[model samples]
Target: MTMVSNEYGKIITIEQAVEMIDDGCSLMVGGFGGIGSPPSLLQAIIDKGVQQITLICNDTAFPHIGVGPLVAQGRIKKAVVSHIGSNPIAGQLLHEGKMEVEFSPQGILIERIRAGGAGLGGILVDIGVGHEWLAKGKPTVDIDGNRYLLERPLTADISLVYAKKADPFGNLIYDKSARNTNPLVAMAGRITIAEVEEIVPLGELDPEEIVTPGIFVTYIVQSNGVDWKWIWE
Candidate 1:
């Protein structure tokens, strides 16, 4: 088991955060592309040689960014995400039958994760009903004379998230557009590790400004402060 402190949201090194995970673990990673990815923690996983992971994220990101490196490094065996257009490596693996990829609608994907955190059985939606390819073998629910697909909740052994700032207690505030899917990702993991640019004192974060509550976070790692220039810029 990983170390747990009563001190509440203790800040640890990326190496220590890596110790909490093992090979073949299920992970939910928070990011749209690589914008809000946890670089230090992701690097730690690469360094530790963890492999055969099942990843849940919005996308695989570009080949050089975010969890894309993990894919490039062959650490992921299966990925549940919206698309792999950004990462040619992921697409290569998918087509080669080297990786198992599950495609889910973006809205349904996040909602399923949120449902997992909320302890729900699953959710019902009609996004893929008519498309037999999308519907596949999933069970259908008829509610109020309408049919919908039963989307199962997705929970993970651990979740990795990036935040702009965090209090010692683990309350987080993301930077601008980097906030995507992080709050939901923070909630869906059995244990969540946050990598943040700054870790302030416990009271530094205002309650109203806090996006993800400390209760959802198990550990925190300060960011490496490397500037990630946006491709658009």
Candidate 2:
């Protein structure tokens, strides 16, 4: 079989994209309650059964959607995320000592990812300065008597994102609230794979509308399969 040599210019299959990942990888998944999650790519990853993956996402979503299946499948060894309220599977796994979960404030979490993309060491925020349990030995600095905790950058081996539209060069546009967290996740990965609903010609995407430039995207996959509906949806 002839492989597509230029990942940015052409669309790759879900299998091709999934095969790029390895076991024990740190991954950033873009979504908020399954809105911008990459279902086909995730299903591919689930099929691959890559174990010990550490996922960073806004939420775990439902047990059958987004990163929840990975948790239910016992593939995720650790997760660094903002909330697990939507998915009881994550909380159950954590309680069972089957998985480890790291909590983060939404703003602080995104800033850490942004810092990594910008090549910054970290950012200072007072979000958790007073909570000694949350500080966990992080050094604090006083800015003229006010104190703040230093939150370090977050980078990942792989990033999975979903887009409403993408050009052949991988420039992306997202649909409404679905755009949440995807742009940042795109930049924080060493290898970013985008799952897009539509792939158009290289010059078709409007410059201003493209939230994520193709420069940050390493590969592209056309969206496939039926949409996974949440239990509440």
Candidate 3:
């Protein structure tokens, strides 16, 4: 693994952090209505002008928040999300054929990531048995002479998650309601990148509080705070 550590392990810059992200890759972003987005890192990507991304997120919040800015900028070519009802830009993109939208059920979306992280080839779920938009593959496997629909693995090139604190070794601690889909997404990606408000020394955190271990994390970026309004309150 290509792990970079500074003298104090705190010199990781936004540019250095997001440099690993490449265009035309499948990405999963962790945040609910932009509440936990890594603002500095996301802005860096916007500033860098990367394009042709397939984003997997919970909800495409209104323009300028969550995945909305990326979608509005035309950087994201496709999105697999739970809900796109909150963003007008998303609807416009879909209507204009500027973006491809795949709306998965909220619950199955979580399982898809979790299954990928666990090294499973895929998961069998009953969320979208007859849906058209999100359902494309018809995989049948017989279990005890019964048939079941298969939900394939959703592996991402990169997963961007926001956390309250992370140790230099990459252990993560998400604050309160900030833990959305981040925990599972952290492991589902080939390269998991985390943006946190604080990055501390290793062994400084209680083992019980570590939601994600260093093995699953590839990079750590320091985030001042998310740019969107908190909705979980």
- The top-ranked prediction according to TM-score is 1
Task: Tell me model 1's lDDT, rounded to 2 decimals.
Answer: 0.90
Error of 2 at 221 (Å): 0.6
Candidate 2 positional error at 220, Å: 0.5
* Candidates 2 and 3, the one with greater TM-score: 2
| Candidate 3 lDDT tens digits, 43-106 | 8888888899999888887787766788888898899888888888889889999999887778
- Computed on alpha carbons, the lDDT of every model, listed in order, comes to 0.90, 0.87, 0.80
Clashing pairs in 1: none
Query: Model 1 shows how many backbone clashes?
Result: 0
* Model 2 lDDT tens row, 1-233: 22223434557788889988889999999999887999889988888889999998887887888788888888988898888888888889999999999988888889989898878999998887888799987889899999999888999999999999988788899999989999999999999999998887767778999999998998889898454444647
Could you tell me the lDDT of residue 218 within candidate 1?
91
TM-score of each: 0.94, 0.93, 0.88
Which sections of candidate 1 miss by over 4 Å?
A: 1-6, 230-233
Clashes of 3: 0
RMSD of each: 3.7, 3.0, 4.0
Model 3 ranges with Cα > 4 A deviation: 1-11, 130-135, 144-146, 227-233
Backbone clash count for every predicted candidate, in the order shown: 0, 0, 0
